[model samples]
Target: MLRKVALGSGVIALIPTISAATPVQESSKEPLKPPLMRLSELPIYEAPHAEYGEYIKSKAKAEKNSYLRSVIHPQVQAVREIAEIGIAHTESLLHTVQDNYHELRDRTEWIVQYLREEDNKEIRYGAVAMGGLTGFIFGLRGGIIRRVFYAGIGTMAMGGICFPEETKEIAKRNGALAKQYINIAYNFLYGVKPGDPQLEVKFPELSLPKNVSELTQLTINHWRVKNRSIASEKCEVECFEDLLFITILC
Candidate 1:
């Protein structure tokens, strides 16, 4: 119980920062554009076009040997499949949640119309009428019909006040779940636990406009190779701090 209390307090402390990032300001900014070709984008050029053209070509060609798959073990394949499934599922849920919001708005319009019939008066007068009608319907500690009417009016008014927020909350919840499935599934499959958790692998997301999906996928592949090289060779990767935002492979 004491541990739970501490964890709850820590989480509550984080609420402010989490909420701060999510406000409309984050969405209002324009996306940054890529300025130059990444290293990966450059072709394996001949000597005149590339400083180390011969070395680059021969190196890539050696790695493309037929026996290459022998080095890529089965476990890695399993994890890659899991990541692929997550990518598919998250994208699907994104579409579904987006659709549901539009449906909710349509339902809200229907409720508003039905509400018009229920309250013959305008909203300026309807508040008092609704309050009184609400009381009359439920005041007697009510009959079956009274309870239903009272609930309908109460639901109508409450939805008018809060349904938009509720709809947003629902969509947000679904989106979170979808992202969680992807993040957790990927981490569990790959065994590289998450430290700075964020929604990732947003399809086709890349700094460059052309071939964004391919570029991002290439980065993922490079990251995987870098990860393995580090593990097997005990080689520490240079951070390349200046190029942190840029793709290392490109």
Candidate 2:
């Protein structure tokens, strides 16, 4: 009984020691929390002028956009349409001008060709008539002096008729000759010294027959040669003359 009472006393001593160790372990495991601050201790933030400025700018931009849509858009559209119309008109006008230019060029070419052909025909007719008339005039004359004068006249007429372009040059030369003669007369009559240079009369160089008989023979031979050449070539417009003859008969 005395030994059992001693064991009970020892168990009571271990309970206090376990209670002290539990408190020390609980303190070591838990962390300490920071103290809470009051609303008055918080940081004060000031509003920036830049944010207000940006708000004002955005509001103004919206108003400007609305005004432009209402007032300026229609006018811009009208101007754009007018510009397109003007461009179209200008392009059409350019096309018309180009077409007219081409047409004018074609007409001018045709007219020039027609005039040249008519001029050639007239020259040919004039040549034939002059040659015939000169031959006839020479045949009528009798004396040597008279015959020589007629021949000279006939030769001059024939040469001028044969080449109309040369005749224009001859006319210019004749005018110069007359001016020279007048200067000479002035020098003699009024005692004025001639200042102009002397210009000689330039005649057309031709392979003409010497006499009237030879001239007539040459004309006949020329016609025969021309007829032979025409006969040798393919007759492109021979029927035109016949048609004209038929029309005249009708």
Candidate 3:
């Protein structure tokens, strides 16, 4: 039987509440800025040392440990079983949530962008049609007024539909990632002041299945999916250190 010291969840403890690896919603009241190219438009950053170091090292080492347990030395596994399970669970959950959200968020943003462009085209055509129809029904003078009246309303309606309100609503209703991240953020908003994410070592009796080798493969699958799909091209933090830690947890 293996017993392991639980590694503290570096992320859930040190990061911000919003570190759930999800997107943040844009406030409708906020004026539109440059178009969002990626979810990084929200506040999220990568830890310089932590990103390449413990994060990856821990994961890779765990993978190595898993392999060793299955193929080479099931005996040593008795020493560090619980910690491995917790690490895999923690990393897999965060990375999977974040990577999955990133893909969906990017796709939604692009769809909104396309619909807005299409809306502009429709407005232009509607205006042109109104002018031509009015000319056919009334004299040139009446046609001009009618064109102005009807075309103005048509354009305004299209503007309303394609502009901030529609996009904002769509982003709101469909923004599952933002909601999820926000929930995570709330937990961290107050910070690790609450204490570290529960470490498994605190309860050595708690252990994962004896057949743990398969879990390693499952976690690797999650990591690969996250790497392939999720992207965070930008982030800004009001508190650099806090935010960096938060990003790790996220």
Candidate 4:
């Protein structure tokens, strides 16, 4: 009985030791907590096929391009069209202004030339008629003062008609003087310097004589020279005769 009790106590001590060792073995066997791995140490999963990754990338690119075409391209094109239209409209407006400016310049030149022509006898006749009509209208007034004014105007009209050549000479001198005064005024008011090259003075053509008799002689001499040149060129005799007739008439 004594040996049996000693053996049982020894077995009881070994049971506690085994129980402590069991917990240690169980903790160690619990996968070692994956060796305390860091996030970078972890294995990354790859696609099963390499082409599959390329296909996914390509599809994403295609979808992006499609979105650009559908959503953004139309807006860009519309903006370009609007810009082109605005440019064209601006060009058209500029052209219209240029055309109008040219037309107005031409009309002004025509009016100036018409007023400057000394041979426009209609202007003198019209002036005389206007003066006569004004005088007649004022004469109808009852006062002696108005009668005197009307009589003076009638006498001036008669003098203008009777001495038209003298009147024209006086007018030419006055017009030239007035032109100088006008130019002076224009330069003073518009900040234009004297002797500016842009303000060119146009002299009358030397070839064209102002007097009718001198102009007729010049025309006859020109025709004679031209006929001689034409005769040297073997022109027809009938044509030469016709030209001589025209020259004589001129």
Listed in order, each prediction's TM-score against the native is 0.25, 0.29, 0.21, 0.29
lDDT of 1: 0.64
lDDT of 4 by residue, 91-127 (tens): 9999999999999989977854664457865775565
Report every candidate's CA lDDT: 0.64, 0.69, 0.59, 0.70
- Runs in model 3 with CA error above 4 Å? 1-79, 118-161, 165-250
TM-score for predicted model 1 compared with the true structure: 0.25
Question: Looking at model 1, which ten-residue stretch has the lowest summed lDDT?
Answer: 26-35
Better of 3 and 4 by TM-score: 4
Q: Which is the better candidate, 1 or 3, if ranked by TM-score?
A: 1
> What is the TM-score (0 to 1) of candidate 2?
0.29
lDDT of 2 by residue, 121-167 (tens): 77655654666567557767577666666655665565555554765
Better of 1 and 3 by lDDT: 1
RMSD vs true structure, all candidates: 43.8, 31.5, 45.2, 28.4
After TM-score superposition, the amount by which residue 80's alpha carbon in candidate 2 deviates from its true location, in angstroms, is: 2.8
lDDT of 3 at 237: 35
**Candidate 4 clashing pairs?**
none
Each model's total of backbone clashes: 2, 0, 7, 0
